[model samples]
Each structure stands twice: as structure tokens, then as C-alpha cells.
Target: MAGYVVAAILLFSAVAYFVGRAAGERFVSANGDQVHSLPGYHGAFVAVWVGIPALILVLVWLSAQGSVIDGLVLGGLPADLVAGKTPSEINLLLSEIKNVAAGHIFSEPTPEIVAASQALLRWDEIARWAMVVVVLAMLIGTMFVARLRLAPRFRARTEVERVLSWLMIACAVSAILATLGIIVSLLAESFAFFRMVPLHEFLFGLRWEPQIAIRADQVAGQGAFGAVPVFVGTLVISCIAMAVAVPVGLYTAIYLVEYADERVRNIVKPLLEILAGVPTVVYGFFAVLTVAPAIRQAGSLMGLAISPNSALAAGLVMGVMIIPFISSLADDALRAVPRSMRDGSLAMGATRAETMLKVLLPAALPGIMGGILLALSRAIGETMIVVMAAGLIATLTINPIDSVTTVTVQIVTLLIGDTEFDSPKTLAAFALGLMLFLVTLALNVIALTIVRKYREQYE
Candidate 1:
């Protein structure tokens, strides 16, 4: 019903736009030079009034109606059915009633439950129809009112601009609030984790076991929260990835910008960027089914021991995944340098290689560094490739052939099952997340500082 109402509102809004535009055109034909705003602005103003208010009403109504109906149904239930029930128990009962009402009954329900389900269904129908009526009335009434007010001096453009400005402000505020909310939640959960596990043990302890006995008789490892190994693994993998990606990506960008002709640039750039569009999961599969085995074989031939799931495999795949990010950004940065600089260098008898190496590289250093940092962040946060190719044992070793786990992989492992949120095991994920966020945030700040310093010098 709500969907139908929205469709009706959209159809009517389109009609209102054309009608308002025709009205504005008519006024212009009659009172030639007197109209304040263009006919398109008048149409937009009318369409905004026609759609936005009605849509907002529908949205608010739909958001609220389910809880309101549920409350009313629960209140109508017999007191004996709900007496002495805790909030969780009551919520479960309500869910059962809703399921029975929707014909998903797994067992027979009592008389009171049946009656409550009937009431729920009836109230839902009533609320949906009421919403539809109210939304339609608002749409039609606002359309008429806005059309009546459309005059030569209506200032429709000013009104439309004000609405758009407010919309943008609302979007920006919502994004900021969401980010703040995430930080606050992470801090709260991480604080809970720190209370349960000491900060020093988590930060400096050598072991990484997180298993804890949930019941007295259950067999489990003594919980260990030392995160040093996880942190080290993350650094080793990221470093390996950057080792492969930075030089290759930068060289590719240099070739594209300084040497390649238009046709070659067009073909090669797209083919290179297609790597970025490939899903990370596909890269994970490639690492596990292909790269890891090949690395193990190569290690065997060299009389070296290599884990089946090794950091080298994951790092190589991840580096390939990140090449496009560095390449594209570096390409854009190199292109953004002034053509006059290149011309002047050539006129000064400098070879193209000398001009590029001596002048263009330094000028574009900021953007290239920015891309490297971005790719580093991407490498650190990647989970699937690491999980598949890098084993989950958080070993404190830097050997690329040895298996190790990263912070992201540990966070995922800790939160994979039906775990209690209040448990240290579960809360540990939040602590890891908070750490990841801080690292990424620091990288971004550093990138911005570098960009700003170089940008000032160049400008």
C-alpha cells in the first residue's frame, strides 16, 4: 500500500511539473516581461511541493506504524499471557504472534494469541490505508496551493534554492553524525574490552589466543589477547604489498603519461584499471587456488619450507589488486602538471627522460604519495585474500613464506559465531576495529599533510 502511494505521488508530481510549467508559460505569454523566475524553476518549485511533503509523510508513517501496531496488539492481549514476562520474553512472544499471523506457524497458538494476531492484522490494514489517504491528500492539496501561488513575482527560484540548500545541509549533517556514532560505539565497546583485558597485555603480550571458556566445565584455551603478532602480521603484509605495488604502479603511470600516444594510453589505461573493478573475492580465489600452490612449489624447488597458506601469496595478490589505485591517481597527477613546464624543459635542451625524472616526478610527488597511502590503507583493510591465502595463526614472524594472520582476519574470526557481545572475545573485535580506524585515520592525516606541503610549493 505504501509503495502504491509513493508511485501515485510520483505520477502526480510529474503531472504537476508539466502543469506548472504550462501555467508559467501562459503567464509569460500574457504578461511578457514581468515573470521573476524561469518557467523551469516554477515547474521545479511545484514538483518539490507536490512530492517532498507527501514522501516525507509516507516515510514517517511507515517507519512508525509497525511499532505502534505491535504495541496496540500486545496491549490487547490477555494479561495472563504476558504476566511476569521479561522484556525479552515479551518480545519473543510478540514475534511468535506476528509469525502466526503471517501463516508461518510452527505450532498451535493459544486463543489469546489468535485474537491478538487478528487485531494486529486489522490494525495494520487500517494504518496502511490511513497513510495512503493522508499522503494523497497532502500531495493534491500542496499541488493546488503551490499552483495558486505561482505568479509573476512568486520568487520560485529562491524558494527552490532554499529547499536544495537545506537538503544538502541535512545530508552533510547525517554523514557527520553517522561517523561520530561509529567512533563513540567503538570507544565504548573498546573500553569494555580493556576493562576485561589489560591494555598492556593486549598491546604487548606475545601470544594471540582469544579463546575463553564460556562455561565452567567447557574445555578452552586460557584466553590470551596479546595483539603484537597480529599487528606485526598486518605490517609485514602491507609492506610486502607496497613493495610490489609502488614501483610497478608508479612506472606504469609514468609510461602512460610521458611516453604513450593517445591510442595506446586509451587502451592500456582501461585494461589496467579493470583490475580495480574485479572483486576481491575473485582475487582471494586466485591466491588460494593458484598463487599459494605455485609459491609452495617454487619454495620446494629452492629447498625452502613454505606454509600452504603464506603471506607472500596474499601480498602478491593484494599488490595486484592495488596497482590500479596507484596507477590511476599517479596518472591524473602527472597529467595535471602544466604543459608549459614540459615545453620549457624541452626548449632548454633537456631530454624527455631528464625532464620527466628531474621536473615532472617531483611536481607530481604529492599525488603519487597520496595514491601509495590510499593503496596502503586498502592493503591493510583487506580480509578475504588474507583469510584465504594467509593462515589464521598469528605467528610473530616476518618470513613471507611463513603463515600469519592480520588484524582484520583476527577481528573476523573473533566475531564469526553466535557469540555474546559482553564477552571479551566479542568485544575484542571492537578493540581491533578501533585500532584499525586509528591507523587509517593517521595515514589519511599524513597524506593530507604531505599533499598540502607539496601543493604549497608547486602552487
Candidate 2:
């Protein structure tokens, strides 16, 4: 019903725009040279009035209806059944009622639940009908007022521009508020985690266990939250990935830009970028099922031990996954170098290789470095490839052939199943997440600093 109302409102708004424009044109012709804005501006003014207010009201109604219905349904429940339950318990009961109301289950519901579901469905229908009526009335009334206000000398364009400026400001403010909300949430949960485990221990201690027994009598040992080992593993894998991606991707970009024929370059560049669109899970599978086993076999032949799941396997596959990102960005940066730079280098009697190495490459260094930093961030944040190819045993090691886990993997493992939300085990995920955010932020800052410094020099 709500969807139908929206569709009707849209259709009405479109009709209003054409009618409003015709009215403006007629008014302008009757009082020539008196009109200040174009006919199209009057049309847009009417369309905005017809759509924005109605849409805002519809959104407000939808947001409020759920809580209003929930309160009504829960308020009428039997006093005896609701007497001793906590808020969480009440919420769980409501979820079950909702599920039953939606016909998600085949089993019979209790009498109280059945009553509540019926009440909820009735209220939902009433709300939907009320919303439809209110929205349509608003669309009609606003459009009527806007059409009446359209005059020969009305400043329709100015009014329309003012509304658009406010909309832009609102969108900007919403994004800033969203970012602040995320930071506040992370800080609040991280503080709770730190109360259970000291900040210093989490930051500097070498071990990385995060399991905490839910009950005192549970057999599990108390978990350590040292994060250094996880950090080390992340660094090792990321370094290995960068080692494979940077030189290879950059060279590929150079070949496509400076050496390959136009036909060959066109064919090759898209194929290279196809790597970026391949899902990360596919890379994970390739790492686990294909790359890891091959590495193990090769290592065995060389009289070296390699884990079935190793950092090297994850890093190599991740590097392959990141190649497209680096190559595309580097190609753009390389292409941005002026053709005159190459021509001048050739005029100086420099060979093509020397010109590329000493002139074009240097000129494009900032962009190439930017691409590399971006790829490094990609490698650091990657989860699936590491989860499948690198085993989840956090060990403080630089050996790429050893099994290790990253911060993302640990955060995921800690929060996987049903667990106490406020417990340190769960809060630890927030702590790790905050650290990852900070690390990525630092990388971005560093990249910007380098780019700005070199950009100024080159310019």
C-alpha cells in the first residue's frame, strides 16, 4: 500500500511539473518582460514542493509506526507472563511474536503471542492506510500552494537554488555525523574492553588469545588479549603481498603504457583489470585449494617445512588480487606524465629505456607511490584470503612459510557465534577494529604527506 502511494505521488508530481510550466508560460505571455525566472524553473519549483514534503512525511510515519505498534502489542500482554522478564527477555519474546506474525514458522503460537500478532497486523494495516492518505493529501496541498505562488515576477529560480543548497548542506552534515557516531561507538566499546584487559597488555604483549569462559566452572582457560602477534602477522603478510604486487604491477603498467602497441595494450589492460572484479572469496579458495598445496609441495622438495596454511600462500594470492588495482592506478599516473617530457628526453639522445627510467618514471613517481600505498591498505584489510590460507594461530613470526593470523581474522573469530555482548571477548573485537581504523588512517595520512611533498617538488 505504501509503495502504491509513493508511485501515485511520483506520477502526480510529474503531472504537476508540466501543468505548472504551462501556467508560468501563460502568465509570462500575458505580462511580457515582467517574469523574472524561466518556465522550467517554475516547473521544478512545483515538482520539489510536490515530492519533498510528501516523501519526508512518509519517512517519518514509517519510522514511528514500528515502535508505536510494538508498544501497543506489548502493552496488552498478560501481566503474569510479563511480570519478571528483563528487557532483553521481552525483546526476545517480541522477536518470536514478529516471526510468527510474518508466517515464518509452521508451529502453533501461544495464545498471548497469537493475540499480539493479530494486534500488530491490524495496527500495521491501519498505519499503512493512514500514511497513504496523509502523503497524498500533502502532495496535493503543497503542489496547489506552489502553483498559486507562481507569479509573473516570482523568484522561482532563487527559491529552487536555496532549497538545493540546503539539501547539499544536509547531506554533508549527515556524513560528518555518521563518522562521529562510528568513532564514538568504537571509543565507548574499546573503553569497556580495556577495563577488562589493560591497554598496555593489548598493545605490547606477544600472545593473542581472546577466548573468555562465559561461566566460572567452564573448563576453558582465561584468554590473553596481547595483540602484538596479530599485528606482526598482519605486517608480515602485507609486506609479502606488497613485495609481489608493487614491482610486478608497476612493470606491467610500464609495459602497457610505454612498450606495447595500442591494440595489444587495449587487449591486455582490461584483462588485467578483470582481476579486480574477481571476488575475494574466489581468491581465498585459490589460495587454500591451489597455491597453499603447491607451496607446501615445493618446500617439501627443498627440505623445508611449510604449513598447510601459510602466510606466504595468502600473501601471494592477495598480491595477485591487488595487481589490478595497482596496475590501473599506476597506468593512469604514468599516462598523466606529459608527452613533451618523453619527447625532450629523446631529443637529449637518451634511449627509450633510460628516458622511461630517468624521466617518465620520476615524473610519475608520486602517483605510482599513491597507488602502492592504496594497494598496501587493501592487503592489510583483506580478510578472506588470510582466513583461508593463513591458519588462525597468532604467532609472532616474520617467516612467511609459517601459519599466522591477522587482526581482522581474530576480530571475526571472537564475535562469530552467540556470545555475551558486553563480555571482554566481544568488546575485544571493537578494540581490534579501532586499531585497524587507526592504522589505515595513519597510512592515508602518510600517503598524502608524501604525495603533497613530491607533488610540490615536481610542479
| TM-score of candidate 2 against the unseen true structure | 0.92
Supply the TM-score for candidate 1: 0.93
Tens-digit per-residue lDDT, 222-254, candidate 1:
799999999999999999999999999999999
Question: How big is the RMSD of model 2?
Answer: 2.5
User: TM-score of each candidate?
Assistant: 0.93, 0.92
- How far out, in Å, is residue 14 in model 1? 1.4
* Candidate 1 local Cα displacement, residue 410, angstroms: 2.7
- Model 1 gets an lDDT of 0.93
lDDT of 2 at 69: 88
| Candidate 2 residue lDDT tens string, 1-459 | 878878988998898899789988997889888889889889989998898788788878888989998888889899987899999999988898899889876687898898888888898899998888788788889989999999989999999999899989989999999999999999999999999999999999988877778887877758899999999999999999999999899999999988999999989999998999999999999999999999999999999999998999999999999998789989999899999989999999999899999988888888998899899999999999999999889999999999999989988898899788999899999999999999999989998998898888778
